[model samples]
Target: MDAASSLGIDKIGFASAEPFTELKDILLRHREKGFESGFEEPDIEKRVNPELSFESPKSIISIAVAYPSKLPNPPRSEPGAYRGIISRSSWGSDYHDVLRDRLAKLEAFIAERVPDARLMSMVDTGVLVDRAVAERAGIGWSGKNCAVITPEWGSWVYLGDMITNIPFTPDTSIMDQCGDCTICIDACPTGALVGPGQLNSSRCISFITQTKGYIDDEYKRKIGNRIYGCDTCQIVCPKNKGMNWTHQPELQPDPEKVKPLLIPLLTMTNKEFKEQYGRIAASWRGKKPIQRNAIIALGNFRDQSAVPILSELLLADPRPEIRATCAWALGRIGGEEASSALNNAQAKEQEPAVRQDIEKAITAVSQSASR
Candidate 1:
């Protein structure tokens, strides 16, 4: 085998199918919403399991691509005002695109060797519990943040899996190295990491970013300037400090997304939003969530400069959710101008929830205007 194929080890033998018998029992619990099995969908059980055989499927090959980057510190004096905190993983192109391309290439290599091979690929898909499989395959141990942590890559890597009829040798699973470190749990701003190796998705900033509508005014204030994803837990982990890794160049973000200026993202048109974020994982939530997040970040920044943009969103956006969030942001921004804009928006808003938000904004801006 050539060097690339040799490194990927597509020719290795499969772990015995019998060993995976227990996997089904575990998957049962994983499909539940509150479970950490990482299986997000209920239907996945029918599609993948020990019983489902690849016509020639003999082994599963899993690959991990490290995504660690040298993160710069957010400005400390007014920590929340700093807009530099892009989730290190998402600052570039979507990892799914990068990992999928690499997996396809690897699958081709395996197919070249085994002509009749069948391949099923998953990278962060609902079908397979990626971290569990990675642990079983000996790639890394699950860290307290619930992310797989490789000794070399730290916890900053994207995982990919390919199941083929060709049996390949399995890698040995590694022992947990967390060693009682509770750094990730402590670092979570929202207490999302409630315990070791457990995450409450509802409390996670990353999850919040994916959600649309008026988040609790308090929650929006806590969200800081992160418009996409949050990486505070990962950032504080000792393992990830100063680590960099080999990344697929294609997945790198557009320069604008690297550390987006909050002002521009709020003003992006539907066409512009699509043009900029359409291909990214963040885009799955649509522009509304992102725009809402930008508004919150602007509120957190307390930069009156964002007042005009937030005001425009308050009036121009058709989505009641956006209107509500903008109202809240204007409240947080607190100025005579902000109050006037919110008051005007409140007059036109038909939605009760939005009208309430406008009232709250009026209250907050009224308070800020007094100061």
Candidate 2:
């Protein structure tokens, strides 16, 4: 624990490597309800049993690193200069790298004590459920928002863990503090939080933003100005009120990159996108999803000034998702130029899906103009 504290780990706890029986049922129900985000490992046995990760695993060590919640001197978003926000989780340098480095250091420290100590470490990509491990290891209680909430740091922390052959004293789990609190569920824009501690990932704006295809029209307006993940559930949680952690320097947000101008993002090339957002976690899905979401944000803002660039994208952009989203944005902006662009796109657009999008956008613009 002393070594972990010295290595800048905010919280650490140990747990027995016994199979997670309770989680299996929960996950089974999650699958039955079609709530999975498709990011999880498909094999349920590997997910529930720590033994699958390592031979003779006796204990697991869970660690948490607090990340910053607030950005300093954030750029202002006005009518002409609309900006889209990347969630707090994706604000800093990729947390996977940061957490992996810390875990490697922790492993080295343990190896020094137990020569020939066998260990397997993992971050978010690992098959093991991080929040489940953290909860069992007493790092924090799982919140109704599905976040592991540490009393000291709220839910603003990155989690990682290691499975080890060495037996260790298991810490007691924290008592649930989300009693009678329906704030996160009530605040969900899309009603993705179906119940306490339950999430319908299909409707989650965070998951919706990461999807590659054209977003559903129903969710388009609800996405608001989020370019990456949505933080509405976390922001509304009472436990997270007034909680901000800025201790880890690597976790601090670069205001401009995290909250960037929406207009510039539409025309960004692959190389340009990589150079700017390559190090952040949100860039994992690449530029397509982000660009698509940026177009949606422009529509949500209804910024008439964006109509020109959006019209250009509708005519010239090669990606159907981009072209289609631009049509939607232009329709929302609704002007003579925007309507003309949609009509032109309807005439020339070859892809059936994109053509339908153009037609729908034309109708939307016509309806708005009528009002």
Among these predictions, the greatest TM-score belongs to: 2
Q: Which residue runs of candidate 1 sit more than 4 Å off their true CA positions?
A: 1-39, 44-50, 53-57, 71-85, 253-255, 369-371
Model 2 Cα lDDT, one tens digit per residue, 179-225? 99899999999999999889999999999999998898999999999
User: How many residue pairs clash (N, CA or C atoms closer than 3 angstroms) in each of the candidate models, in the order given?
Assistant: 13, 0
The Cα error of candidate 1 at residue 87, in Å, is 1.9
Against the true structure, candidate 2 reaches a TM-score of: 0.99
Candidate 1, residues 305-362, lDDT tens digits: the string is 7788788878988888888888887888787888889878877888899999899879
Off by over 4 Å in 2: none
How far residue 245's Cα lies from its native spot in candidate 1, in Å, is 2.2
Q: Give lDDT: candidate 1, residue 205.
A: 84
Worst 10 residues of 1 by lDDT: 9-18
